[model samples]
Target: MDDLIVKVVVRLAGVYENHGERVYLDAGHRALLGIARAVQDEAERRAGVGGNKVEGPVIKFPLDRAWREKKDRDDA
Candidate 1:
């Protein structure tokens, strides 16, 4: 999985445009958020916020619960 992500980063970096960097950064941020969300404990998640003054909760559900909710919502 880490290798796959590294490959994606390399591919994104190869693109010769400013927008490619923006997209790559967005993907990186999402990856970090996913990692943070996977960790248990609200305090840990909050710590992951790292002094950023975000208005709401930093992380959502774990991957499984998030997928299940998404599937349920889609089925409905």
Candidate 2:
């Protein structure tokens, strides 16, 4: 499950770069969050866990912040 998440993230990052975009907007962040949540939820459900409980900090918060910072620095 973790591997799947990593793969998805890497693929998305590649797509973003290939598209000539230095930063992602809310839509991109939401897409990432949706993918992660879906994968995690499915894994939990398969394990007999009821309800989607994402353990750990929200991935988008840090990711979006870091990307924005990088974009700002690059623009400057």
Candidate 3:
């Protein structure tokens, strides 16, 4: 997979023309764009920010050893 990605990137290397010039994207870039679009659409469909989401300043804490210990203590 790494080799394939490298090969595609190498193929994409070139001196691009100035703006307004009709240029075609490499096969790799086209495929990547398609895949990205598909993934984005799927994510949008599955990820619903409906009435379940609460509006607020959300704070995220790292799950470290100390946090785990506190959680265990609280559970007990």
Candidate 1 wrongly placed segments (more than 4 Å): 1-19, 41-76
Instruction: Quickly count the clashes in candidate 2.
Output: 0
- Candidate 2 lDDT by residue in tens digits, 1-76: 9998797678767767776464545446877778787788778878989664657764445458788899999999
Pick by TM-score: which candidate is best?
A: 2
**What TM-score, over all chains together, does every model reach?**
0.33, 0.36, 0.30
- Error at 40, model 1, angstroms: 2.8
Tens-place lDDT per residue, model 3, 1-76, is 9998786555555313332223325444665876686566557657863332434644344489988999999999
- Find the candidate with the highest lDDT and give its number: 2
Report clash pairs, candidate 1. none
lDDT of all predictions: 0.66, 0.72, 0.58
Provide the clashing-pair count of each candidate structure: 0, 0, 0
Colliding pairs, model 3? none
- Estimate candidate 3's alpha-carbon lDDT, on a 0 to 1 scale: 0.58
Ranking by lDDT: 2, 1, 3
